[model samples]
Target: MSADAVRYLVMPNPYLSDGVLDVRAVQPADIEAIRQWRNAQMDVLRQTAPISPEQQERYFAEHVWPQITSLEPSQVLVALERAGVLIGYGGLVHISWSNRRAEVSFLLTPELEKNTDELIALFSRFLDLMKQLAFEDLGLRRLCTETFEHRTRHVATLEASGFRCEGRLREHVLIDGKPTDSFTHGLLAVEWKNGQ
Candidate 1:
């Protein structure tokens, strides 16, 4: 399908904590915000790779926008907004209808880390939303994610939200030119529903 021709199949937005955050499809204006968030990651062990405005615009106009527009019937790209500010984002990617599986990734603004509870709540909402789409809408049986070892906080959030660590990939990626390990996690749709 032509990239631009792919139509977005919208799903109901899901919010975990009452009156805390609102998550839904990505909009045109969200592109700049996302770029800024990614670029803002430049401290401690985690670094936000810089993205110039021109590059950001190109990415949005070329990749992200069209990907969301042509998202598979089973996939979704969501942005989390709090008090009218874009605070985080999560999405189901690489959807495989035949395998009934997808990978998920997310990021939160640096400022939100101090409020751990709220961050967890946002992740919970995203996972639940993915569960609904996988089982109810697409009838998928599995959802998966991978995280770096240093991101212990994110792993904790995922576990608290019901996903379990299944295995680890040693030297998964070269970060700062050094090999790093990654943990693979997954939650079955049935398991998610039962946990609720």
Candidate 2:
């Protein structure tokens, strides 16, 4: 479907915390903020150096806009506070209706990524919401993600969220012109349910 033809609807997050965050649909106005947040963390969140505004705009046109259009293309969500500050974003990618599986990824504002704070708590809550979307709302059997080896915080979060490393692709992707290894982690519905 065309990017302009796409539509979005706000959805409730089944995964709730003590009023810490609210997950809902990403609006047009939120794109610029999300892009800035993502680019600010490119060293950790992306395989490349900081992305230019043009490149980011193109990505939203060609990639993200296509995904959140509906249940078929995939899901995209933003986590906000009562004041409507965007703190994080996440989504399912490459969804397969037949296999009921997809890859997942998420990112938080750089400040919230600090390990000494409630980074783990914020992440755990987001995972619970996404897992519910996968196992119940979407009826997906599995979800997975791939992250660079250098992104230690994300790798740890994946492991702590019941995902097992399926494999590692050595020197698989480039970051700031250097090659880096990437690891794939997978989580099953059962594993999620058992709180593994």
Q: How accurate locally is residue 133 in candidate 2, as Cα lDDT from 0 to 100?
A: 70
Q: Model 1, 56: alpha-carbon shift in Å?
A: 2.5
Against the true structure, candidate 2 reaches a TM-score of 0.78
Candidate no. 1 TM-score = 0.79
lDDT of 1 by residue, 1-196 (tens): 2343323554432332236666666666677777777776533224446888899788667766665534354456677777777887767776887888888867787777557787677777666666775677667788899888877777987888788999999987777777889898999888977876
TM-score of each: 0.79, 0.78
Please give, for residues 1-196, the per-residue lDDT of candidate 2 as tens digits: 1345334432234333346666665556667777778777776665355667788778778876766545466555544443456777776767787888988867777788766346777776677777777787777899999888987777887798788999999998777789889999999998877874
**Which candidate achieves the best TM-score against the true structure?**
1
| Candidate number with greatest lDDT | 2
Deviation of model 1 at 46, angstroms: 11
Q: Report the backbone clash tally of model 2.
A: 0
Worst 10 residues of 1 by lDDT: 9-18
Misplaced by over 4 Å in model 1 are 1-7, 10-19, 42-49, 67-75
